[model samples]
Target: MTQMTRALMTAIGATLDLGCDAIPSPGPGEVLIRVAVCGVCHSDVHIVDGDWGAPPMMPLIPGHEVVGEVIGLGAGVTAPAIGTTVGVAWNGGACGHCRACLEGEETICAQSEGTGYSRPGGYADHIVARAAFVVVLPRDIDAARFAPVLCAGVTTYRGLKRAALKPGAHVAIIGCGGLGQMAVQYCRAMGFRPIAVDLDPGKLELATRLGAVATVQADETDVPQKLRDIAGEAGLRAAVVVAPAPSAFTQAIAAISPGGAVIFIALPAKTRDYLPISISDMANHEKRLIGSNVGTRVDLLEAVELALTAGILADIETLPLQNANEALDRLRQGRVPGRLVLTMA
Candidate 1:
């Protein structure tokens, strides 16, 4: 590896620039990963575009879904030995004293620090991650595919768990993008009938190929009634909304059955602008509206286990680290088909 590492920075005012910086040493309770691949996710775009209000940490190395080998460890580090492969996710570190963390909701800890947002992330050749926040993985797993399991996998998995759908129940996955695609696969793995709903024909087709029992073209068909018809006696047990659009949430809600849940995983830039919920409908049906952030360490373990055991992975394309800005631009413009992975080599 180069002495001066390469990093992509989200510069002031949301512009991205690449530069060389001195490699950082791990702090106490931290581990330094020799980053093999960094999975570029929509959340990075949001951070670059100033979507989550002000930047949590300015001029950031914006990447969170990280997979690499542990080459260095800080004081008190034991497991995830040097040369071991691991993944760093969205939640970088959390304050264990917070109520949320105490209750095992580390993802929602008041002092939770985001990987790319609050600290340097895997856009570089080497990144320092909190040992408690990283996931130990098998050395032989596919780097490109497993990298996405750090973020997209765990997020959707937590969304499914929020739904609490029973086996053989009918579930709806809204939007067939990176997150939605994984949601459909997980839905099928959990023994549920996955009904994929998407505006794009290509995305819907991909969802079908990924084990969705049925598909709904959002631009053409009626979402609620079509879902109800397909669900039959199961009556739409749960709905996982992975689209960043406001309409997706409403459609997911419309498709849900009595006592079912709508688990929201996407954070649309204008999400607060236009969300229409019916109090009467929610009350009458006993439906739930749940918002899921990234997952905890326990959740990450389960997600990776599922990914390793069930052949679940993202459809990936690779880019050199130098093209990080271009990759972010393409993602923002909706040009990339699936997840875009950045290679540190």
Candidate 2:
């Protein structure tokens, strides 16, 4: 058994605590990772504000966009050789016996485990992850640059996949922030012409540069009508809401064309923030409302390949682990441009 000294930053009752601890070796089917960088996701901000019901276990190491080196492997693990660069995401593990898992929809499995939320994750020196769940990354990509791809990238990709839009179809993406930016890039790479919607002009401009053919200012009173005018009477084939606002859901529903799928990948700070969905409207228009979690392990692998092959990457900022609290603060304050990451040096 290998025990190594590690310095970790933990979430303690809405505050961050930096401390030194010893990390244990991996157990069977697990791989020990020497973390190089971990991305700061908006979900981490919500957890800090106690938005997800009861507080998580004290001293929770919160981070899901993890990139690291496979330092040690437990029994029966092969491939992803020791020292391989790999990534872990929001999903940690799932019960393969469940119907959802058996059907390859493990992201929605009843016994699904989340990295930062359900268990200890990145934001530390090392993490022991399920070998089957870790994604092997290209050694050439910088760890900090690709960290967010493990979470934000895969999430939006899966969200778009759920829509199952035809190639080259027009798809509207609401919210042009971290996740939304990735959504725009993925939309283009997947062959969909993306219409970006956001209240922030700067973000909209960024989205346009990233491949969005159209941009809508969300603050406009006639968001739905404006969307229709831009998308035309034929309507959109799909819409993805990456903005963590209930209003974004309502806007997506109203703007969707007939038979369009509205995929939601973001959770608002509170359930109360969710908008009312009229049952009649859904049946009349046949608009599909879809909920997409982070995505399955296979999706994560494909997303990594997409990033490496298509050059779809998020804008990221790197900071030391000690600045974890400051990074969370910036995310909550909406100051971060794309993604903020904590480097474990």
* Local accuracy of candidate 2 as per-residue lDDT tens digits, 1-345: 344323333444356777666786788889989988999999887776677864445556778999999988999988579989889999899998898998999998988888877777798878989998999887777888788888999999998888888887788899888998999999988999899999899999999999999999888888888777777766787889888788888888988888899998888766556589989889998999888888998888888888888898778889998888889889878998889988987
lDDT of 1 at 96: 94
Q: How well is each residue in 1-345 modelled by candidate 1, as lDDT tens digits?
A: 446455555454455667788778888999988899999999888887777766678678889999999999999998778999899999899999888989999988888999998988888898999998889888898999888889999998988887777889898888888888888888877678899988788888889899999998888568889999999986998888888788889988888899999998888776565787999999999999988898998889988888888899898889989888888889888886778999986
Error of 2 at 138 (Å): 1.1
Each model's TM-score? 0.97, 0.94
Write down the RMSD of candidate 1 (Cα, Å). Answer: 1.4
Q: What lDDT score belongs to each candidate, Candidate 1 first? A: 0.86, 0.84
Worst 10 residues of 2 by lDDT: 4-13
- Candidate 1 TM-score versus the reference: 0.97
How close to the true structure is residue 26 of candidate 2, measured as C-alpha lDDT? 84
In model 2, which runs have C-alpha deviations exceeding 4 angstroms? 1-12, 55-57
